[model samples]
Target: MLVVFDLLYREYCRARLAEMQKLLLLAGESAKPSKEGHGAADQSHDEKDSLQQRGWHAAD
Candidate 1:
């Protein structure tokens, strides 16, 4: 039972870490201006919209 719990906990931590990394990447992307001269805010909005279209939610 303890081994099983440990495995489950490890899996949960791994998944959480992956989610956090994704959120951090999105945040970093949102903070940068687009190469095409677009503002960071506009770029962020576009990214969020794209994520929403794909059924993914951006961190608030």
Candidate 2:
């Protein structure tokens, strides 16, 4: 029973570590500047329009 618990705990830790590493990689990528010069402004504008079409008011 102790051996089984240890194995399960190790597997859980490994999975959590992998998930954390993936998130760190994504965070690192997002921190880099956009190569096209335009950044969040362009993306936000498009998103705002999409939201309006979906009846998502800013005040709401």
Candidate 3:
């Protein structure tokens, strides 16, 4: 039972990581043109602010 639980947990983690990677890739593609047309620094600042507002932190 313990071994089965471990395997299940690992599979769940792998699926979740894959989903996150896909989302990140999509976001990157969407942001490319905007980043190039605007300024890199401005885009970075906006991303940081948005993340902060959403309660995400580097320390996390």
Candidate 4:
């Protein structure tokens, strides 16, 4: 049950991130900084590290 809940939460987060990205793009008329690393706070540290390498630094 716990594992299933985690999976569902991640999926929900991903979907919300997608929506936010679309909104930002439409508002700016251009791509936002990080196309793939939406919702970095909810993502794993390793994923965030990769994003950092790509020039993203999470808020401290």
Candidate 5:
């Protein structure tokens, strides 16, 4: 019984570790800066367009 419980606990820990590693990898990838020269400008333009389409107006 003890051995079975220990094995299950280890498996659970391994699964949790794998999930954390995946999350870290995704976070690292997202934190990387874009390689394209105009990426930021393009993203900003798209965001502004989306907001305007949703009836969001800039404050004067």
Candidate 6:
């Protein structure tokens, strides 16, 4: 039981960390202004990254 909980908790923490990293990356990007309409595209790429990367929680 303890092992199970530990595994689940680890997974949860990894997911949350991945989610936070995605948020930080996106926030870092949005903090910048660009003449090109690439923000959406870049955000989409970040969204897709979580999907492709394991132990990641993708934001809706």
Q: Which stretches of candidate 1 lie over 4 Å from their true place?
A: 35-60
lDDT tens digits, residue span 1-60, model 3: 999999999999999999999999999998876435578788898899998877865556
True-vs-predicted CA distance for residue 46, candidate 5, Å: 24
Off by over 4 Å in 4: 30-60
Clashes of each: 0, 0, 0, 0, 0, 0
Pairs of residues at least 3 apart in sequence or in different chains that clash in candidate 3: none
Question: Model 2's lDDT to the true fold?
Answer: 0.90
Per-candidate TM-score against the hidden true structure:
0.55, 0.57, 0.56, 0.48, 0.58, 0.54
What ordering of candidates by TM-score runs from best to worst? 5, 2, 3, 1, 6, 4
Q: Candidate 2: worst 10 consecutive residues by lDDT?
A: 51-60
Candidate 2 collision pairs: none
lDDT of 6 at 39: 78
Best by TM-score: 5
1-60, model 1: which lDDT tens digit per residue? 999999999999999999999999999999996578678898799999898877744343
Off by over 4 Å in 6: 35-60
Model 3 segments more than 4 A misplaced = 34-60
Estimate, for each residue in 5-40, the C-alpha lDDT of model 5 and write its tens digit: 999999999999999999999999999977677687
Residue 60 Cα positional deviation in candidate 2, in Å, after optimal superposition: 43
Worst 10 residues of 4 by lDDT: 31-40
| Span of 10 residues, lowest total lDDT, candidate 3 | 31-40
Q: Sorted by lDDT, highest first, which candidate order results? A: 2, 5, 1, 3, 6, 4
Write the number of the candidate with greater TM-score, choosing between 3 and 6. 3
Give per-residue CA lDDT, model 4, range 1-60, as digits (tens).
999999999999999999999998798876445557556564677686788877744444
